[model samples]
Target: MVIDSLLVLGGLALLVLGGELLLRGAVGLARLLGLSPLLIGLTVVAFATSMPELVVTVAAGLEGRPIIGVGNVIGSNIANILLIVGAAAMIQVMHPPRGLAKRDGAVMTAATLAMIVLAFAGTLFWPHGLVFLLLLGAYLVGSYVVERRSGTTEPAGEAAEALEAAPQTWLPAVGLVLGGSVGLVIGSELLIEGAVSIAKSVGVSDAVIGLTLVAFGTSLPELATAVVAALRRHADVAIGNIIGSNIFNVLGILGVLALVTPFEFTSELLVFDIWVMLAATALLMAILASGRAIGRGTALAFLAIYGIFIFVQFDTGFATAVQSAVGL
Candidate 1:
């Protein structure tokens, strides 16, 4: 048990380090290829931060535990909004950039609604997965075009700074990208192994493990990035990171996994967790639309909601009782 615990921790550490390195290398390569910073931020950096989730979900799907894959994506999206954004806002009031609140915010809400609609389909197959990928591609292209038309060249603030600081040399950059990709792959395998072992030992569902431990572990990179951005008073960057990540979690990670192996919806996921995710997302959008910063009080409320969510996951009885009382 101790060995598995240690392995999970080690894997989490590797994921964080690997994600940073990957972002650095990818940003350097994008710059070398003359990609605009805005485009790079919307694509490369956003995707890099989500690599851990992508790797874990794909690994879980390949291992035939599709529930874990789906759960990880749903859990990560919830965590991104509730935990990451809430914690960051508590550090400092998060005032999102106007353009992001208008554009990316709308896209995130639409993507989230799309997920809810897709979930009702009961199972996600290759055709559905292809649709997700196509939507994602269209979103990227549309965002790029919009930014170009509006002449918004600046990227998400601190995130762009971090990428701009990466090594400019092509060889070392390529090495970092390759090394990071390898590290992410190995770390994901170890993480999934440890999680499955621990789940079996504790007699818990794989979805529970994915929803809590696996989800939190894979989200470390975003947490770190958001906290750092918040401290720097770049709240837009922090908020942008969470929103962009949530979008990618659903569209990119799940889409890729579904392409490789179809995932059937678990009843608990459909009944409770997916709605919770949508609610959390809705809360974020409401806050953003209010044209006010996410203050300490609101942050505390978000944290409390997340704490209740985690508790419900572990105590199925509590979840069931609540659902019954609510007539769900």
Candidate 2:
């Protein structure tokens, strides 16, 4: 048990370090190519930070543990909003960009709803995966066009900060990206292995393990990014990272995993967790639309809810009682 616990911790550390290296290198490379910081934040940095989720989900799918992949994405999406954003906001009030509140925020809510609809379909097949990937493509293209039309060429506040701290040369930057990718792959493998073992020892289901342990472990990068950005007074970066990461987890990671191997939806997820995720997203959107920063009070509320969420996932007796009550 101790060995497994240590492995999980070690894996999480690697994931955090690896994600930072990957983001720094990728941002530097993008800057060298003259890409706008906003574009890098939306695409490169967002995708880079989400690498841990992508790697873990793909690994789970390949290992015939589809529940782990599905649950990880669902759980990560929830944590991205409640845990990451909440923790960040507590550091400093997070005032997201108005355009993000209107545009990217809507896309995030839509994606969450879409996932819930697909969950009820019983299974995610290749065709469903293709549709999701197509949607992601369209979203990227549409964002590009809109930003261009608006002449919004500035880099994301976070991306600009990252660029300032990145290596100034191509060789070291390329090395960091390559090295980070390798480390992330290795770390995810260790994490999944340790988590599966621990789950078995603890008599928990793969879905439960995925939703709690694996999900939280993989989300560390986003947590670190958001908190750092908030401390730097770059609220847009913190909020934008959460929104972009959530979208990628659903549309990009899950979509690709389904393409490689189809996965069935767990009834508990469809009945409870999916709705919870959607509710969180909706609440976040409302907060953003209010045009006020996510204050410490709201942050505390988010953290409290997330605490209940984690508790519910672990407390099978309570979950069972709730499921029975809901006729799930």
Candidate 3:
């Protein structure tokens, strides 16, 4: 069990390192190809950062842990808003645009509401997949449309950021990406195996692990990125990283899973975790709409909320199962 835990942790480390390398290589390649930074950020960078969740979800679904696959997405998004953004704010001030609360926030809210509605409707199958994909298409098209209407060569300040990268050191970048991506897959395989082993050894369910460890493990990059962005006073990167990553976790990660696994929604998920996810999203929206930018205190509040949620999730099951076994 100890060995398995070590392997899972080690695998996660490699996954994160690989993802970072992939991002660097991808940025260089995009620049060499004359792709705009916003294009790269929105697609390449966003996808690269989200690769861990993508890899892990596929692994989970393939391993018949579809709950983990789906739960990881919800947990990661909640962590993105609470833990990641909160940790970022603890480092520096984050003044998200009021427009973000109005626009992208609405989009996120819509997605959350849609998922809830689906959950209430019973199992999420192909129809849910189609809806998710359609919304994803709309988002991509909307971004493109907005960019075109602005009539700007790049989104505001994007051009300046594009020129800031070093020259195309594509050779090493490619090597890193390849090595990292391979390592990520290998690591993901090992991590899932270890997590399952540990869960069984300790008498925890796969869903619980998905809600906590696997979910938290997959979210390490978001936490790290947000922390760094906050320290650098790059709150846009922090906010964008969280939002973009969440979108990809659903639209990209789950999209890939559906393509292969056709995830089946479980009563366990609807009863236990999905409501928490919706509440967390709503809380984030409330925070965004508060007219006050996220600061240290706001971040602290998020951390507290997340901590409470985690405790409730674990404590409930632990009490029920362990107490029942003990004839309590």
Candidate 4:
């Protein structure tokens, strides 16, 4: 038992570390290919961060555990806001950028609403999945086009010049990218496996596990990235990472899971978690558009809200435990 727990912890550690390394290398490569930082944040970085959720959901769906997949998506969205953003804000005041408030805020809200609507449909079949994917593609393309039209500068030239001036070859860069990908995959796998084991041991449903453990686990990368960005005072990356992650948790992970393995929608998800997800999304929007960036007070409010949510979840679980103990 101890060995299993250790392996799980080790796997989780590997997964987060791997994801960070992979994202750095991937972002560098994207920049090398002339992608603007904002576009990279929206597309490349967003997708990279979503990969763990994608892997966990897909794996669960394929294994006939639809609850895990569904729970994972819903849970992840909640975590992105409550845990990731809250933690980042607590670490340092996170202010939303002007573009974030004016544009991405609306986009994130729409995506959240779309997920709720899709959840009610009872199945994430190919048609629905395709629609989500198309929306994601459109968003990416639109962002890219806007970047180009705005005459935004690409950091690729600087990166390439730096590489040329340094005593380095393409081989090292290629190795870093490959290594990062491998680490992310392996780490995510181990983390998911551990999560499932832990859930079973704790006598919780897979859905709850997804809601608490798997969701938070997958959001670790976001937490780290956002907090670090916040400390560095890069409001755009800090806030962008959170908002972008929320979008991908719905559109990216859910879309891919539906296409790969259609999940039977749980009405419970609609009743409880989806509303929580939407509420969290709304909170983010409210904070961003309040005409002032998120400050210490806002962060405290988020943390408090998160605490309430967790308390409610635990209360429900404890009630179930009591009921079971008394044969209710």
Candidate 5:
């Protein structure tokens, strides 16, 4: 058990390092190819930070533990909203970015709903995955077009200027990409092994571990980005990041998992957890569309809700615990 814990910690560290290197290398390569920094920031960077989740989902699917993949996506979405966005708002009142709710937020909610419909069949196969990929592609292309037409400079302009200063040489960039990929593959393997062992030891379902441990592990990048953005008074950026992440977690990661290995989700997820994810997405949509600042009060509510959600996953006495904690 201790060894498994070590493996999980070690794997998490490597995943973070690997993802950072991959992002830098990809951005450098894009720059070398004459891609604009805005494109790099909006597309490459968003996709890059999500690589950890992608790797884990694919790994879990291929290992015949497909529940973990689905749970990871569901859990990550909940964490993105209740945890990441909440923490960011606690740092600063997050005002909605203009038109984000109408577009990306709408898409995110749609994606969550779409998953519910698809997963109701007990299994989602490659065809379903293909459709999801197509939808994701449409979303990306449409976003790029709309952003271009609007001439949005701030989003393109203020996307971590340091990202532009990547490796100038092809050799180093290639090395980073290769090294990062290797690390991701190895890290994912170790994480899965440890997670499965931990699940057995704890007498919890694989889905539960996936939702909490693996999901949080993959979400580290998003959390760091949101916190840092909050400190810099760029809370909107953090909110937008969470929105994009939730969409990708559903469409991109799950789509890829479907293709790699189609498997049935546990009833716990199809019935309960997915609905929780949908509720979070809907709540986020309403919050963003309100065009008001999300302050510390909202943050505390989100955190409290998330705490309850996590506790319920591990304990049968959730209602009693909540009552005791809230003095109700």
Candidate 6:
């Protein structure tokens, strides 16, 4: 157990470091390739940052533990709202664009609903993955065209902000890209192995570990990004980053993963966790619709809810009771 704990921690560290390097290298490569900043931020940066989750979930599915991947994606979506956004809001009130709820939130909600619909049959296949990918592609292309026509400056500015710490030279960038890819592969294998070992030792399902520890560890980068954005008073950035991550978690991570290896969601997730994710999504929409900034009080409430959710995931009896209540 102790050894497994160390493996988990070490794996998490590598994932973060690896993800950072990957982002830098990929961004540098994109910039050098003459890609626009908006294109880099929307495509390369978004895909790079999500690599950690992408690797973990896909590997899990391939290894016959599809539940872990499903839990990771679903848990990540919940945490993106309740944990990452909440923590960021604590640093400063997040004032999203007035139209964000209607536009971006609608897109996110549509993605969420799509996930639910795809999973409703109690299984996800390559066809489902195809649908997700198509939607993601359309979103990306449409967003790029709209932003380009509207002359949206935020993505370019955000790209510049992202580029500030990245390597400027091609050699270092290429090296980092290769190294980051290796790290992510090794780190994901270690994480899955450790998480499975710990789950067995504790008599918990892999789903439990995936939903809690694995999910949180994989989300570390997002947490850091949100926190930094909040500290810098980039509330929209913090909020937008989280929202974008959530959308990608479904459309991108689960999309490619399912195409490679069909995912079989666990009974645990099919019952309660997915609904919690939907509830969290709806909560964010409600917040956005209300036109109220996410202040400290709201942040505290979110954190509290996050704490409760984590606790419930680990308690079979509590989860059973909740499931029963829902079934009723």
Tell me the whole-model lDDT of each prediction, alpha carbons only.
0.84, 0.85, 0.73, 0.70, 0.83, 0.86
Two-way lDDT contest, 2 vs 3, winner: 2
Model 3 C-alpha lDDT per residue in residues 1-328, reported as the tens digit of each score: 7899898898788788777666676667777788876566556666677888888888888787877778788888888887888888888878876666676777777777777776677555665676677777778668766666767455322223433542476786677668768877887887788888988888767777777887898889778766666666676556755765677677766667776676665555666577777787787778778867777888788889889878876676654764465455
TM-score, predicted candidate 6 vs. hidden true structure: 0.95
Per-residue lDDT for 47-95 in model 5, tens only?
A: 8889999998998888888888888899999999999989999999988
Instruction: Find the number of clashing residue pairs for candidate 5.
Output: 0
Give the winner by TM-score: 1 or 2: 1
Considering every candidate listed, which one attains the maximal TM-score? 6
- The segments of candidate 3 whose C-alpha lies over 4 angstroms from its true place after superposition are 151-170, 316-328
* Model with the higher lDDT, candidate 4 or 5: 5
TM-score of 2: 0.94
Q: Arrange candidates by TM-score, highest first: which order?
A: 6, 1, 2, 5, 3, 4
lDDT digits (tens) for residues 1-328 of candidate 4: 4655775677667767666655666666766777556566557666766777787778777777868877877877787787777777777766566667676678789988887776776666888888888888887787678767878645232122223332233455566668867876676667667767877676666777777767777777777766766676663456766676677777777888888877776545555667888888877787777757666677777778777766665576664664565455
TM-score of 3: 0.88
Each candidate structure's TM-score, on Cα atoms with residue i matched to residue i, is 0.95, 0.94, 0.88, 0.85, 0.93, 0.95
User: Which segments of candidate 5 are over 4 A away from where they belong?
Assistant: 153-162, 316-328
Q: Which 10 consecutive residues of model 1 have the lowest summed lDDT?
A: 319-328
lDDT (C-alpha) at residue 317 in model 1: 82
Per-residue alpha-carbon lDDT of model 6 for 23-73, expressed as tens digits? 889998988888888888888887888899999998888898878888898
The candidate with the higher TM-score, 3 or 4, is 3
Provide the clashing-pair count of each candidate structure. Answer: 0, 3, 0, 0, 0, 0
Report the lDDT of model 4 for residue 287. 70
Pairs in clash, predicted candidate 4: none
